[model samples]
Target: MTTTISPSRKTNEAVRPAKQPLRDRLVRLQRRIPIVQLALLVLVCAYGLATLPGFGSWMSIKSILILGALVGMAALGQSIVVLIGGIDLGVAGYIVAGALMVTQFATLNNVPFGVAFLLATAGAAVLGGTVGYLCHRFRIHSIIVTFAMGSVALGLAQLQVAGAYGGGAPVWLTQMTSPVMGTLGLPIPPLVLVWAVVIVLAALFLHRTAAGRRLLATGANPRAAELVHIRTRRVWVLAFAFSAVASVVAGVFLAGFAGNVDVTMGNPYLFESLAAVIIGGTVFGGPGDYSRTVVGVLLLTVLTTVLVGQGLTGADKQILYGLIILAAMAVYGRERRLRDQV
Candidate 1:
C-alpha cells in the first residue's frame, strides 16, 4: 500500500472472474457425460455395421433387441440390489426355479397357464424374501447367502428336470408371446415392450416416489438412514423381493422364447445381469438410475451382436465383453471419485 500497487496488478486482480458454483459445475458435467457415452456407443455400433457385412440386417437388429431385452430385465433387478448396496447372486437360481415351476405346473402337472405363471412368480418372491430375511436377521453377507441359495435353486431345478428332455412350454404361453410384432418390417418382440415398460416404471418410482428415496438413502448410508428412523431392513427386504420378481418375469420370457425349460437355462444370465448393471453407469454403493441401465443394456447388446455377426466365437465375445465392462467401471469410478472430491 505504501509503495502503491502497479496498475497492471490492479487490472489483473479486477479482471479475475468469480468461480462457478460447485453444484452448477457438477450439473453441467453430468449433462455432458450421457451425451458423450451415447455418442461413443452409437459410433461403435456404426463402425461395426459399416465394417461387417449383414450387421445392419433386420434379423441382426431383431436378435440384438431380443437378447438385450431379456438381459436387461435381469440387469434391472441387479441394479436395484446394487443401488441398495447389496448384490443378488441368486439371479440364475431364481430364474431357473421360476421357469421350472411354470413348466411343471403348466405341462406336467396340468394346471391352468395363468395360475401356473402366478404361482411361479410367488414362489420366487418367497424364496427371495427368505434370503433377504436371513441376510438381515443373522447378519449374513448377502453375497454368500445368495450364492448358496443359487446352488440350492439349481439343485431343485435339476431335480424337477430329472434327466428328462422333452417337456415343452404350454401352448397358450407360446402363442401369446410369439409372432414378433414390429414396425415396417422390423421385428419387435413382446418381451422387448415388456422390458421397456418395466424400466420406465422403475425409473419413475425411483425418481418420483418417497419409497424410492428411502431405498436410495439406505444404500447411500444405512446408518444415517437408520438414525432418521427409516427402516433400512424393510427397504432391503423389498429390494430383494423385487429382484426375485424381476428374475421370474425374465424366466417367463425365456420359457416362452425357448419353448421349453431346461435346468441350465438361467445359468448365463447371472453374469450378464451384473455386467449390464456395471456398464449402465450404476456405480456400486452409489447413485443409480434405470435410464442409464437401459442404455447400458443396449450398448452391450449391440456390441455382442456385432461381434457375433462378424463370426467371432462365443468365448471371444465374452472375453471382449469383460474388457469393455472393466473399461466402463474404470471410467465410472474415476468420475465418481472426482465428483466426491469436488
Candidate 2:
C-alpha cells in the first residue's frame, strides 16, 4: 500500500524554504562574480599589510586612497565607454589637458575656480564629442579615433603649458586633497569621501535609471538595441561624454592631490583604469558589470604601496600589472564563452 499526499499539502511543502545544497550555494556565489573581486581585494590587503611593516599606517592608507581615487575616477569613465563596446584611448589626453587647463586658467589667466572648471569641462566635452563623431560618422574603430585624439591632446597640453607651468591649488581644493577627519589614530582623506560619494552616484546612475539600463543594453548588443529603436549612436556619444567628464574630474583632483600636473602625468592612468575595471569583474565590450570597481582600484593602490615597500622597480610593477590584466581578460573571455554556451 502507498500513501498519497494532497495537492495543497504538496504545494505548501514546495513553497516552504529549505536549506540550499552546498554545490548550489557555491554556484550562486560564483554567479555573483564580484564576490571574487572582493575576496581578492581582501587577500591582497591582508598580504600587503601583514608583510610590509610600514604599509598599514594611516598615512599609507590615505596615500593609497588618494592614488586609488584618481585611478578609480579614470576607471569609472573607461567603464562607461567600455560598457558601450568602446574604448577611450583619449582619456589620458583629456586628463592631461584638463589638468593643464585648470591650472593655466587659475594661475596664468587668474580666472576664478568656477570659471576655470567650466572651461576645462567644455574643452573635454568638445574633445569627447569629436571622438564620438568620428566613431559614428566614419564608422571608424573607437580605438583609432581616440588614440589619435590622445596625441592631439598631448600636443595641445604641451602648447598650452609652453614649457613652464607652476601653480598651487586653491585653499579649498588643498584641504580636500589633505585629510578631512581622523578618529582613533586613523586620518581620513577628503578624497576618499569624494570617491565614495561618486561611487554611490555612479551606482545609482548605472542601476536605477532607465537611461543607464539603455546604455548597458546598447553596449551588450548594439544590433538588438537599434532593433528596439534605442538611439545607439546617442548612447555611444553619451558614454564618451561621460567619460570625458570623468577624466576631467580625475585631472582636477590629481592637480589638487599632486599640487600640479605634468604632460606625462596622465599616461599611467590609461592602463591602470582599464585594469581596475577588468579586475573588478567588469568585462570589456560586454554588459557593464561594475561590482564596485573602486575595490579593484584600491587593491592596485595597495599593491603599489606594497611593491614600493619592497623596493620593487617600475618595470617589476608593470610586469605584474600586465600579468594581472591578461589573467583577468582570460577569465572574462571564458565567462563569455560559458554564457554563450549556456
- What is each predicted model's overall lDDT from 0 to 1? 0.77, 0.78
Which regions of candidate 2 fall more than 4 Å away from where they truly are?
A: 1-28, 180-187, 337-342
List of clashing residue pairs for candidate 1: none
The candidate that achieves the highest TM-score relative to the unseen native structure: 2
Best by lDDT: 2
Residue-level lDDT tens digits of model 2 in 92-202 = 888877777778657877788888788777777777877887797688999998888777766776676674567666766766777554434546777787888888888
lDDT of 1: 0.77
Per-residue lDDT tens digits of candidate 1, residues 261-306? 7777887888888887877777766766777777878887787777
User: Which whole-number lDDT from 0 to 100 does residue 63 have in model 2?
Assistant: 75
**Alpha-carbon RMSD, each predicted model:** 4.2, 3.9
Residue-pair clashes per candidate: 0, 0
